[model samples]
Target: FVFADVIGQIVELTPIEVVSANGKETHKLTVELRNEKDERLPMVLWGNFATDVSDAIQGRGENAIICVLRFGKIKVWKYERSVLNAYNVSDVELNPLTPEVEAFASLLSSVYIVMCTIAAIESDMGCYYLSCKVCSKKVLNVPNDNIDEQGDEDEMGFHYYCVKCKVKNPRLMPRYKLHLVVLDNPGNSKFLLFDAIAMQILNRPCNELTGSNFEEMQDPEDILLALKDLV
Candidate 1:
C-alpha cells in the first residue's frame, strides 16, 4: 500500500457535493493544500470524511487552518496525481502541534498584524450579509408557504436557508463583509474584512444597523461616519 503524509496550510476548500458513484449517492469534497515551498497539492475526501472536514471548518469559522493528513493513499486520474483517504486507516489533524507543523506554519504569512490608514471605504460593494446562526455561513432567503393563520409574515416575510447546514428557517445573524481601500508608506491596496475582523475594527455589531431586515443594504451615514474616523 502506497501511503504519504502531507502537512500544509489549507488554501482552498470547495463546497461538498453529492455524486452518483456506482448507482449510490455519496459525498465529495476537494481541498487544495499549499506546502512551505508554495507548491499546491489537491486532496479529495469521500463519504464521511468530506462531511467531517466541512463541519470542522464551519464550526471554527477560521479563515485559515493548518492540516496534517497521514497515511493517505496516492492516486492518479487523467495523469494528475492526488491524495485520498485510505478508508478507516487515514487520519486528519487540524492545527496540530508537531515539529513539522510548527516549521511549516512559520513560513506562512497569512497571519499578521499591520498598521494602516483608511484611505476610503468602498461603498459600491456594500457591507454586511445575513449569516446562519448555527454555522456562521452566508444564508439566503427562500419562498416559504408555511405561514401562520393570521397571515402575518415571518420575521422577514420569508424563511432563511443555509445550504451548508441544509436547514430551513434557521436562526440568522448579521455579519460584516465590507471592503476598504487602505494606504501606508509604500502604496495603497484594497482589503476585505470578514465578520470577526470587521467587528473588531468598527467596534460595533452589524445588527445595530440592520435590525430585522435581512436584505443587503448600504451602510448608513452614521456607519460611514464611524469609518471616516479611521481615516
Candidate 2:
C-alpha cells in the first residue's frame, strides 16, 4: 500500500501519534529509518496487526531494507504508517558502501590522539599506549590499584597506563600530538588525510621518525618525503 525510497537505519521502533482520515487522533506502531544521506523516515503500523510485524523488525540494526504501506500523507512529502502496515520486507541487508557504515567502521579503527603527547593504540587487551611528539611518557606497566583493592595483586604489572597523566587523571586529558596521512599505492604522489590511528602508529618513535624530527629533512627529495605529512 505504501511505496517510497526507504532511507536511513532503524534508530527507534515504538508507537507514535497519528492523525487518521477523519482527523481523529490515533496511535500506531512506527519504525524510524535514517537513510544513507542522513534523512529520517518513519513507517507506521495500524491496529492489532502491527504487533507481530513490529516485533519482527523492532531491534534490527542500522542499514536494514524494509517495506511498509503508504497509508496517508503526514506532511508535504512524508507519510505515516506502521510495521503492521508493512505487507513485505525487501532486501533487509546492510550495505557496506553507505557513508554511515564506512564512517562508523573507520571510526572504530581510527586511533584517538590525546594531547600531542600520548596516542591510544587499539590492541586486543585494550588500547596500547605510546609516546607523544613533545613528551617522553611511554605506556608503562603499573599496579592495578582497583584490582589490588580486591586482593588481586597477581593481575598487576604491565598495564597500559600513562606515566605522565597518572591513573587518577580524567580520560579526556590530551597526552599526545596526533596526525594522519593516507597512502595511495606505492610510488603514487597523492596523499590523503591521516586518521587518528595511523598518526598513532607513525608516532611509535622510530629512530629516524622521532617527534618533529622529520621536519629537519633539508631536501624535498629525501626518503622522509615519502612519509605522508598529515597535519
Task: Judge candidate 2 against the unseen true structure and give its global Cα lDDT, from 0 to 1.
Answer: 0.38
lDDT by residue (tens digit), candidate 1, 1-231: 479997878866755666778898777888888887778789888888888887787676666798888999888879778898877999998888888888888898875576788887776677777778887766755655655534434545666677678898678898887778888889987777777778897788888756787667654543545556666
Error of 2 at 183 (Å): 36
- List candidate 1 segments past 4 Å from native: 1-7, 10-51, 58-64, 68-93, 96-99, 106-111, 143-159, 218-225, 228-231
Query: Lowest-scoring 10 consecutive residues by lDDT in candidate 1?
Result: 147-156
RMSD of 2: 18.6
- Models 1 onward score TM values of 0.57, 0.25
Candidate closest to the true structure, highest lDDT: 1
- Report clashes for each candidate as comma-separated counts: 0, 26
lDDT of each: 0.76, 0.38
